[model samples]
Target: MSLPELLLAGFLLLSVLGALLLSLPIAAEQPLNWHQALFTATSAVTVTGLGVVDTSSLSLFGQLVVLGLIQVGGLGFMTCAAMMMVLLGMRLPLYQKRLISESLEHTSFAELAQMVRLVVGFALATELAGTLLLSLVWMPEHGVAAGLWISAFHAISAFNNAGFSLWPDSLAREVADPLVNGVISLLFIVGGLGFVVIAELANWRPGRGLSLHARITLHASGGLILAAMACVLLFEWDNPATLGGLEGLGAKLQAAWFQAVTPRTAGFNTLDIGAMTTPSALLTMLWMFIGAGSGSTASGIKVTTFMVLLLVARAFLKGQARPVAFGRSLSARTVMEAVAVALAGMLLVFGCLLALTITEPGQDFLGLAFESVSAFATVGLSRGVTAELSASGQLVLIATMLLGRVGPISLGYLLATRKTESLRFAEGRVHVG
Candidate 1:
């Protein structure tokens, strides 16, 4: 099987195994039926965080199972397998390295081994730091043992961008708290920025550092976050169920920042998603569609893809022959691929939304569409319609989440499995728009 298909198969297999483990009576407070088990497993594997069942209701064993799935899925199946090989003192096979390359979208094999080791070490160290910092609040609030566990679980979840919260409201109670907001927001941001970016930034020097990918990611991500935060604050400032409910401006701003960060596929919510104004919700969908940077745990069309589209638009509008960004001309192939990925993602979201609308005839149109986008983006910020979706609708979401996590880039490649002739065709003339 091709690497993409194998990767896809790996996710399916892991989801089933996780579901089976979580279905056992000892795993959850109430035994999960196959549907609940599968959905939760798929969500965890995709790191989507859309839970039909409240995670708080899950027994510790079930939660742990989910954590395992998130780690496997977020770090990627092949990466973990490769790391295991390293731990066992075995050399990575060439085939395995190819698999890792496909998964990480890396073209260089020379530094592959060193890069993988660095990624794993970096991930563990980040999660540990997050756990230590988060414990300051939770450990005192809940007792030593439960709080420590909670802290660790959240640290992993946030760093992995998994968004699996043990709390019923998913940290809504801590919306105004600076420590909680800052730590969680930073975790998802770093997690979504891509590992390659992180590794480079760690050893960066003054004035001359950062690769083009890292530079693009940092600037685009920062701009999007700031824009999203402004949109949320401006649109929902007076909405009682969201930022308006807070006592002070500082709390509202913190909550706004948290909301802004979550939409880019983190799935953690400090404010009531459904209660936000329509403008804020629409703004969120835009951000979710244009999710975090490439190679990050978070998914969507990706920030780079969105940036490419914007550059393409700019070129067309200015009647330029080529698209350029930051003094570098973008390749035509890169531009076309970005267009394909974005278009495919939008169409998938649309089709899923249409299906859900048919299945859920009485539901609100905007909410269902929002849920579909959230699932397709793997963003996990629901509008309170998740638990209420029918079995078919939930299945649709499961598929979308898988697509989101697996991504359109790989899926697009999967279609062209056969070798093509080196024949060039003339551009066909078509009617102008």
Candidate 2:
């Protein structure tokens, strides 16, 4: 099988295995039906976080099972396999190297071993640090044992950008708490930045600067985060259900910042997302669709793709031959790939929305649209529509999550498999306004 096909199969197998495990009576307080089990399992394996069941209600073993799925899904099955090989001191074969390189989008095949180490090592170290810091905040409240467990679960979820919270209200209780907000936000932000960027930053020196991809990821991410923050503050400041009820500007800003960045495919929100104004909700959906960097835990069309599209527009308006960024000209192939990814993502989201409309006729269009984007992007933010959806509606989301997880990788496969024209064809042209 092809690499993308293998990846899809691997992920599906993991999801199925997870579902089977979760279906066991010991996994939950009450036995979950097949659909509920599959949905939760698929959500975990895809790192999408949309749920038909409350995770907090799950037994300790079930939560651990979900965490295991989250870790594997976020790093990917191939990554986990590679980590094992590295640990065993096995020399990675050429085909294995190709798979890892393509999967991670790592450029240097020669240094693939080191890259795998960095990926696994950095993830473990960061999760550990986050857990310890979060323990300080939760231990005072939930006490020693439960607090540590909560801290550990959230640390893994946050660093994986899975957005799974044991609490029914998520982190809303700590909306004004700096330590909770800071550690959680920081973990996801760094995680969503992608492993390549992380590896580069770790080895970066003053004389040797960052790569273009790193630069673009950092700049676009920072700009988007700030822009979303401003938009949230502007649109929701006066809304009673969201930021408006906050006592002061400081707390409001903190909430705005958290809400703003969460939509960059992190999915943890402090505010009542369903209660936000239409504009704020729309903005949130847009960011969820944009997502974070490629090769990251979060998924969407990706920030890099979004920026490349912007560059394409700028080049067209400036009458330039090619899109340029950071003192480099993007290849025509890159532009086409970006267009393909964006178009495919839009089509998937639209199809999911259309399907949901048919499956959930009583639902509002806006809420359905939000759910569609959230599911496809794996952002997991809901406008209180998830649990209320019918079985068919939930099934539509389950399919969306699965396809959304593999769509980009499959697109990459299609793009990579393209063949150049063997013979030149006659020039064909069409007119447009």
Candidate 3:
């Protein structure tokens, strides 16, 4: 098979294995049926937290299996496989290197080994630190054993931008807790800022500057978080089911900030997502669609794509020849790729929504749209519509999650594949409004 086909097949094989394991009697209090097992496995493999059953319904072994799947999924299994090869001191063949580079959205084959080491090492170290810090908060309430397990689970989940939580309400009880709010949000934020940016930050020194890509990622992430936070605060401030119920400025701000951060495809929620006003819900969907950095655990068209769209529009309005940032001009190809990603993402979400309407005609349109975007972006935040959907509707989401996770990368591969053209076509013009 070609590299892209191989790459996609690997994920599928792993998801199937996960499904088989999850279906075993040991995996759940009551063994899940094949479809349920497959759906859960796919969601876990995609690092999208949407689930048909409560996580707590799973036995200890089952939860661990899910956690393993999350780690493998969050850091692509190819990276894990390559990391194993590195540990064994085996040379990466050209094909293996190509697969590793493709998985990470990286361009350098020579750096694959080093990048793999860094990615795995950083991920484990960061997750360990998160576990320790979170333990301090939960240990006093729940005993050491339970507290530690919870901490470990959430730390891994947050850092992976996989919003799976043991609690049904998903950190709502800690909405006002400063420690919980701070740690979880920080984990996802750092995780969502793809490893490329992380590696740059790690090696950064005085007198050396970040690349244009890193700069735009950092600036756009911060800008989006702040903008979303402000908008959530404004739109939900008077809604008693959301921000208005909070006691003080600190609590409200914490929840608002978290709500803003989660929509960048993290999927954790401090407030009642289904209870938020229509405006806040719409805003959240927009951010969910934009998502975080490229090659990050989170999925969507990615923050850079959204920023490029904005830059392109600004240039058009100003009558500039090209979109430029940080004194560097974006090539036409780059701009066209950005537009393509955005349009494709929109169509993906639209297609899912259309499918849901057919399978679930009685459901609210807005809720269905929110669920469709959530699934396609792999954001996992639903408007409480997930459980209500019929099996067919859920199947539509299962496909969406799988496709959403791999679609962009696969699309990139197809576009980048060289195709010989024997002749040049004549220029054609079309009029637009």
lDDT per prediction? 0.87, 0.91, 0.91
Candidate 1 structure quality by residue, lDDT tens digits, 54-114: 9999999999999999888888888888888988888889988877876666636776777
Residue 155, candidate 3: Cα error in Å is 0.4
Q: For each candidate, how many residue pairs have backbone atoms clashing (under 3 Å)?
A: 0, 0, 0
RMSD of 2: 1.1
- In candidate 1, position 382 carries an lDDT of 88
**Candidate 2: tens digits of C-alpha lDDT, residues 154-258:** 999999888899998888988999999999999999999988898899999889989999999999999999999999999999998999999988899999999
Q: Write the per-residue lDDT of candidate 3 for residues 1-433, one digit (tens) a residue.
A: 8777886787788789999999999999999988788888888888899988889899998999889989999999889989999999999888888877876775598888889999999999999999999999999889899999999999999999889999889999999999899999999999999998898899999999999999999999999999999999899998999999999999999999999999988888989899999989899999999999987899999999999999999998999999999999999878977988899999999999999999999999999999999998988898899978788998999889988998888877766675868999999999966
Query: What TM-score goes with each of the models?
Result: 0.97, 0.98, 0.98
Candidate 2 achieves a global lDDT of: 0.91
lDDT of 3: 0.91
Q: List the residue pairs that clash in candidate 3.
A: none
Model 3 scores a TM of: 0.98
